[model samples]
Each structure stands twice: as structure tokens, then as C-alpha cells.
Target: MLIDALQCGNFDREVFEELKAGGFTCVTPTLGFWEGTLESLDELGRWRDREREYPDLIKIVRKAEDIRAAEREGKVGVLLGYQNTNLLEDRIAYVELFADLGVRVLQLTYNNQNELGGSCYEEHDSGLARFGREVVREMNRTGIVIDCSHVGDKTTLDVIEYSQKPVAITHANADSLFPHKRNKTDPVLKALSQTGGVIGCAAYRNITPADACATVDAWCEMVARTVEIAGIDHVGLGTDYSHKTGPNHLDWMRKGRWTRGVQYGAGSAAVPGKVAKPDWLVNIGALNSVEGGLRRVGFDEGDIAKIMGGNWLRLYEDVFG
Candidate 1:
């Protein structure tokens, strides 16, 4: 499983041990989000210190090669990433600095408009701003993978066409399957695939629209449709699981303007309760984790390999090299 991060506050040695026991070879962890200049640097410093302290259980991985090496060495590769550009603020040079610190993936925005682009929750969806374009260009130039999962539709399409290298929708779903702002339409999937980019299907229940509750079967059906529309080569997996977080975390996620009222649809009053929810809804089922998800979906060995890590690995090599 490619996790988001292993910070001291969010996760600790116990969690890393559990991940190792669960057979997670690597994770693209978030390093910066909603942080200011000094705070961002401090976060980096904290991670650096943790890296030194937990050399045996975890290691910072900067390139695709490092992932393979970690798998072979029986250590979890911690690939750094950022979910928002807030940390970058107005300075573009910070892109290179974060890349040097092992941040390979960066989403252009979070939930609202920033210097880079408008977010999916933004009211007008004004698309990428002037600075947004520069941010994409700078990321490409610095060999960092650009992500557009939380970005607005227009902004996502614009970046896909504008980027010199293939960009990824690191965690999203097909809007046709589930019509949420966070989900992409069929056309977007086609366009992303055409650019050699990969779309990571998120395991969040709210992403699937069939019913209020989601199950593994529902998730597999969604994945099947996405593969049919985008092709198997452009598909990948991103669980987006915050497993250890408490109920307060869910409240926090929903309190945001963009995320307000956006339940995973399981048991949601919006949909009829009779329809079986997507397997991901309960958080304890076949789709609970990456390995179990593939098994339940009946994906062959080759397809499982690609979705689990190969597709992302290929993209990283192309952009981060």
C-alpha cells in the first residue's frame, strides 16, 4: 500500500510495523499541506530526523529505483509528496527545494483557490491561474510529478494539456460512475490516458454513486467501468486511507467548505438504503486495503502488479528521472 505519510503525530513506529506486517512496500506520504514557510521547513526537518531514527523500518525514496530497492530490502519506501501548494505560496523556487527533499508528487491546490489554481470545491471553477501555469512548468522542469485530484475540472484539463510531462490524478474516480466534484468524467479520463497519465481510483465510499453504502463489489464495478473508459494501462490504485484517525478526523474533513455534506454515500440519506453500498464504505471488508482489494476483484497477477504500484512506478520514472 502506498500510504500518504508516516509523521510522528499521524503515525509512529507501531503503525510502520503494522504496514510492514501488512506487506506494504512503499508509500507516497504527504510532507507539506496547509503549512507556512517556517512550518514547512520544520516539517521537513522532523521527517529528516525520523528518517535517521527509523532507518531499519523506513527509508526516504526519491526515485522509482528507490521503490524497487526498498521492496528487495524488505523496508517500506517513504516517497514524499504534497497535497496542496499552500506551502509553496508565491515562491516557485520552493518547488526545487521540496523535490530535493524527496517530494516527488504535488497537487496544484487543496480545497479552494490558491496562487496555483482553483480547487474542485471552488464556486466558479475559474481554472488555472497565471501562477498555476508557472507552477506546473516549474514542477515539470524540476522533475516532480504533478497531481490534479483536488483541482477543478477546467484547471485539471488545462494542466494536462499544458504540462510538458504526463501528470497524474493521483486519487479520484469516474464521475460517470459517481457524479461528485471529486470524480472525473469519462472525457477527462480519456484525455488523461491519451497523455500517458494515470488515474488512481480512490477507495473512498463517497466516490461511488450507485448507492449510499459501498461494498467491494461496487468498487470493482466502478474500477471495471473506469478501465473500460480509460484503458487498463492508465489505471492505478490510491486507497487514501487514514486508518488510524478518529471520528474527529471525519468531522474535520467534512467541515471544510469543499468537503461539507460530501459523505462517502454509505448509509447517506441521499441514496436509498436498500442498495448495497460500495465495499469501501464500512472500512472493514475486501476493499479495506490494497492487497485484499485486488483479491476480491479477481484481478490477475499482472493487472494487480500494475495497479498496486507498477503504473505509478512507470510514471515516476518518466517524470522524476
Candidate 2:
């Protein structure tokens, strides 16, 4: 079974049908990124309507059993998640409220610093703030999976040290391979694995070499090397697939009312705009190509299965049980 640990796709009935037909067992579709309480809750309601509209095609997953059941019934499970803590909005108690609302996965910060903690794009990482530590504790107690993908380096380390439950870098690549700000370093990767956390290697183009065009083989090689460093049990796919989007969406993702100017996320001044995606990894169905690429790269069936989705399943069981 294939599970996408993180996806920010422009979901619709057609997308849901495509995922079901493509044999995806589960996916954590990002519901909030820099969204406030009302906006976030509104998004959740929309997801609920979708489930009602296509009951046979998709269902909201609140537990590991839900994913297994979806797989058994040939339906796709949707795990609602947030890419930032904006919804929490300075209230630690809101953690329980969102957790009760089926928000199982959440990142502490996005690409810039917030009240909770520092971000990867910051000139200096202040590490976890006093409030950030409290947020981590609340998240652990509430069973919300912590994601440090776009968090600053020092903050990421602090979270790995603070959270009692294993956290996840759910949608980032290895810095050793790409050296991008969003990528985690070898030490951070090793430490995350040591804590029994999972790292979902992303297929976002900016996370690969700037000179090289994105390809299935390149993605597979990165995953293989990640397994070699972080172990087979700690690697999975989080593709970070953002399909059916355009420049306006990119502007919102990077600026998000935080700034009036364009931030050009994953883009540069030379080629500033929508970052190109690998054609083979554009959507959930592309997992077939990823599986093929892994097989061609010498991964045994068992290891391939783990990287494909087993590791994420185990993580869900442990964190969201």
C-alpha cells in the first residue's frame, strides 16, 4: 500500500477519484498553512463535505485503523494536517481543540518565524522559544505529530530533544543531497532516526541540484542514500506534491499576509516564479514510477515496501494510536 505523508494538492472530486484509482491507501492533505482559527476550521469543514460527497472514494482518517480499513475497501484515506501553527495562535489549549478536530499532523512553523519558534529562512535561528517548548509539550500530550520540515536548524534540533513522542520531518529532503535551507543536515537526520522518528523524502524540485532537472532516478538515489544514513525504518515518501496550482498560490504560500512583497519560495531572482516539478512525481499516481525507480536502484522488496509506506504506517500507529 502507498501512503503520501504530506501533500498540498488542489483536491477535488476528480482528484479523490484519481487517488482511489491510483491505489493510494492514505494521504495527509494539508488543510492549513498560515491560516487562522476560523479559516482552518472552515477548511476542515470543506474536507468533511468532500468525504460526504464521495463516501466510497475517500474518508477522513483519524486513526491507523482508518487507513487500514480504507486500504481493505479500496478507498483513499485523507489525514488532515497543517503546515504551520498559525491556527493555534498563542493558545496552547487550542492544541487539544484542533487535535479533537482531527488535526493529527502539524508543523511548528512555516518558512519564517512565528510566536512558537524560528524558521529555516531566518538569518538566525533563535532556537525554540519559551512558548515553543510549551507548544511541543501540549502537542505531545494531545497526540499531535510534530513536523519540523520548514523549521530552522536549531529549532529542529530543539524539537527533537523536547518532544517525548517521536516527531517527523514529514516533507523535506536531506541537506547532504541538496543543501537547501528546507533540507535537514546529516546530524539532524541521524538524530531524528536515533529518536525513532521518520523522514519523508520530498520530491520538490528546489530540493534537488539547481543545474539538474528533476527525475525519478535522482529521487530514488536520494532516498536510497537517506536510508543508508537514517536507516530503512526511518525513510518514507512525502513527495510534497503541490499539483493544480499556479503563481498566485505560490505568492500566498510564501507571503501569506506576512509580507506585501513576493517571497519567491523555492524560486530565485534568475528564475523566479512557480518552481518546476518532476513530471514523474506530479501526483499520487506517480508512486508507481517511484516504486519502479526504487526497484531499479537495487532496493529489496521489503525495503521498498517500508520506504513506500510501511514506515509511515508504523509511525502513525505509534504517534496517533
Candidate 3:
């Protein structure tokens, strides 16, 4: 039972093939980040066609039970998610509109500040704004899981405290371990676990480090340490996989329409490419390595199962079921 909390790859037929090869049972593929309402709708529309094109390979997951059914049926459960709430714009009712359209998860911010709040990369950390608070409530009311992987610490906590449902840092690592701005801080990890929120540790190089994931032993060591901080039930695989694509895709993802110049995310002026991935677990299909790594790290089978996908199922049950 392998499940990715989130993945933002240039998904295509080959990618879906790899997901099946990787033994992925379910995944929350990022559908939008900088896209506006029309673009978002078009993206969703593209998926509607894809579902018809590859009916056997995937199933659009509208509920938690759908994920379980996907596993039993040998199909990849597709949970539509977005990295930003840009499509919602200023309207709270759009929250339910998106949920009705099969969007099961939404992040408050991407890598830039918006009406909801600040992003980790932004200059100021605007702890949830008035509109942001309402967005949280509407997301709760609509049953969309709130994500904070790229959100600032303060805003992340703000949503967690104010939300009736548990929020998530869907694809990040432990900051105390890796010290990246995109990673969650120890305090945030503690608070997240306390409130039953889960943090799926990414296998991305910038956040988890390629060397740290060089082997099952090393990878499990990282997972063990994260579990030590966030608890077994709150740690899962988010894997943040970015399948290599055309050169311009990075520019669109990092800069969007907000910047005239390139904005390197988790990278800098010297190295302006996507972070390197370790060879062992490059795609979703290699996720079995994580289950092996956890066992090597002395995690009991039950705890290992929790880390693999059980925890996320429980979370989705609470918000999307």
C-alpha cells in the first residue's frame, strides 16, 4: 500500500506507467500552482479526457474509500491537488466549487505570498490574514485538505490552530535535520503532530539530500529521525517527485507570472537546475525502497505500515472521506 502525499511531475502516459511500475496505489498529483481560474478549469478538463484515454491505469479518487478500491483494483488512485489557492481568488464559495470538481487538497500558498498568507520564500511572514482565516473555514466546510509544504511557519501554524480539520505540510522535510526554508521547523512538526496533522517527508534532494538517501539504510535513518521528531503516526512519504521535463517548465513553476526575472527555488544563482535525485528511488515505482528502509531502521511492521500509507489514509478519512 504505497501512497504519495503529493507529487508535481510533468505527468504523462510514461509517468503513469512508471507509477504502476513503482507500485503506487494512490497519489495526490499537483494540478495547479500559478494557474488562474480558467487555466485551472482547463487543467481539470485535460484530466477528464485523460481518464477516458487511460481508464485502466488510473482512477480519480473522490473519497478515501476510492483509494482503497484503487489498491484492490491495481489502479493508481489520483487525488487532484493544487499547490496554491490562486484559483479560488477572493471568493470563499469557490472552495466548494473546487471540491465538487474533484480537488481534494489545496495549499494555502506556494512559494509566494498571496491573499491567504506569506510563503516561506517571501520577505514577510504574514500570519493568516482575515481572508485567509475564512478560506481555512471554507476549506474545512468543503472537505478539502489544507496543505502547507511551501507556506511560512507562522501562517502554517495559524491555519492549523484555526482549522477545524487537521492541516498538512504535504511535501517537506524536517528543518532541524536539513535546514531548508522549505522544510518544516521542529516547533511546527511538534504542533502538527499534536493536532493530528501529518508531514510527508520528501525524497527530493534539496530537502532530504541525495547522500542522505543514497541507500535504504541512510534513507531509513532520515525517516527514523523525522519520526522521532514528528512521531510515527504523523510521518509519511510525500516524495515531491519532479520528473524531468522541458527546460521551460521550471521557469513557469518557480516564477509564474509574478516575476520578470528567474526566481530559483531551493536553488541559487550558481546552481539553477532542479535538485539532483538519488539513483535508487528516482521515481514513484521505487517507493518500495522506503518500506525496506523503514524495516532496516527498526520500525515495527505496524509503524512501517503507518509511515507507508496508513497515516495518510487516516488523514484523508478525516478531511476527504
Model number with the top lDDT = 3
TM-scores of the models, in the order given: 0.84, 0.96, 0.97
Q: What C-alpha lDDT does candidate 2 achieve relative to the native structure?
A: 0.87
Candidate-wise lDDT, in order: 0.72, 0.87, 0.88
Q: How much is the lDDT of residue 189 in candidate 3? A: 94
Off by over 4 Å in 1: 1-9, 209-214, 247-298
Report model 1's TM-score to 2 decimal places.
Answer: 0.84
**Alpha carbon deviation, residue 263, candidate 1 (Å):** 12
Task: Give per-residue CA lDDT, model 3, range 1-321, as digits (tens).
Answer: 888998886777888888987889898888888998899999999887887898888999999999989888888999899999999878888999989999999999999989999899877898999999999999888889999999999999898899999888889999888988999899999999998899998887767866676876787788899999989889988988877555687888888988898788887888788766766776567788788778877988999899889999999999977
Estimate the lDDT of model 1. Answer: 0.72
Candidate order by decreasing lDDT? 3, 2, 1
Tens-digit lDDT track of model 1 for 254-315: 34334546543222457422333244544322333545556676778787677767778888
Deviation from native of the Cα of residue 64 in model 3, angstroms: 0.3
Give the runs in model 3 whose Cα sits over 4 Å from its true position: none
Q: Write the per-residue lDDT of candidate 2 for residues 1-321, one digit (tens) a residue.
A: 898889885898888888887789999988878889999999989998988998989979999999999999889989889999999879988999999999999999998898878999999999999999999999888888999999998999999999898889999888888887889999999999999899998877777654223578767887899998899999998888886888677778888987887677766787678776776655667676788889988999999999989999998888888
User: Which candidate model has the greater TM-score, 2 or 3?
Assistant: 3
